[model samples]
Target: MMDQLLLALQGLRRSRVWLSIFRREQLPQTEADWLAMNRRNFFVHILPAKIHKGSTRLSYNWIWMGVISTWLFVILTITGLFLMFYFVPSVERAYDSIKEIMNSVTLGRFMRNMHRWAANLMVFAVFLHMMRVFWTGSYQKPREFNWVIGVLLFVVTVLFAFSGYIVPWDQLGYYAAKIASNIADGVPYIGPQVKQILLGGTDLQQPSLLRWYVIHVFFLPLVIVLLIGIHFWRIRKDDYSKPVEYERGRRD
Candidate 1:
């Protein structure tokens, strides 16, 4: 029974969509390298070095980017949670609270900066990774469904950035919210109302602060969590593809 279970797990890893298309491994090659790659026959690249008989897929990279993204978010969450203890979420107190954090709390500034930077980095990394997957045609056929999940994550990331921007309650954040809500007013029939609801009026003010807080702290974060969970699980179900040819041997 244990052996069968182990085989089952191995099957899942080998079949991950992440391994077959995006990951590449170093393999031995002749000194007579083709494509002017004489000095570089097998070194490194994106796709893992493996041959597939259209059935026997070899092992792929297990460092799931999806999981790494989640880990980054986890770091953000813990750091953000610590931040909330110091944050008051009000217009008048917001700036003062930030100062208090830096001066009073031990390593508070470091934690806050880490959370902010990690959130930004997570979004940026996810975007680049998505582009890599798309261009490499990793979303082909059996993986198309997870590609959809990727799209959701993209939107979630935008929402995360937007909502997070307002928490600082800075002048730029105020204007940022104003412009964003103005765009929301272009949503057709109910656009005006949505603009009002989101901005908490026709202007960016206190109500806007609370609204964005609810979204960043409560609503959209929930969606991100849900979508991220599905994204990882589905990748496990989707088919992992293997490269049929090599692009360039990494010498440099």
Candidate 2:
């Protein structure tokens, strides 16, 4: 019975359906095999088959701020989704909804706090990552476009925080939105139109709150996600930027 069961399991493993999903049934045993596996594997295709030794060093990347930022975004997305279930976007109930989440919902306070902190930390991490890239001269040569994208991502990250800031519709949120609109109003020719479009009217009201809520929960998230996908693809295509020493040597 045991022999028959073992044979059955082996047969299953060798089946076409299993082969289609697993790609390689056996673990790679050699360096070449590992390289090929990395090239062929869909899940890891975004990563290069090999990496620079310097890229792995702490001083070069400053504790992998990019990775930390990405993980923080993941945390924010998860906790934000959970909080969304209990969050009412209506102006009348928005603040009370937050109170309810904090006081009544299970794990609600934790999720909200997690979402808030992750959002804050992601902004900080992305800033540090960008600074590291700049100071290391990673923005030179073929990487100039990626640097532009990084700058755009930084702007969007700030917008993400700003949009989310106004969702609760409390005094702080109200003033924040007011201040943002006031800033928009200072942008010269397009300022008034921009403020009008953003607030959906002349002042901060239900329409403004609703607009920001949609942007915070939907539009900005979608935009940032697409940008991140392109950013990672660009990194893979361009390869990780060389360490400062290697870069300088190549130029010299």
How would you encode candidate 1's per-residue C-alpha lDDT over 92-195 as one tens digit per residue? 88867888887899999899889889889888878876875676566776677889989889888878887788888887777878888988999999999999
- What is the TM-score (0 to 1) of candidate 2? 0.92
**Where is model 2 poorest over a 10-residue stretch in terms of lDDT?**
243-252
Clashing pairs in 2: none
* TM-scores of the candidates in the order shown: 0.70, 0.92
lDDT tens digits, residue span 50-126, model 2: 88888888988899898898889899889988988999988899999999999999999899999999999999999
Instruction: Predict model 2's lDDT versus the native.
Output: 0.90
Candidate 1, RMSD to the unseen true structure = 13.0
Best candidate per lDDT, number?
A: 2
Model 1 vs. true fold: TM: 0.70
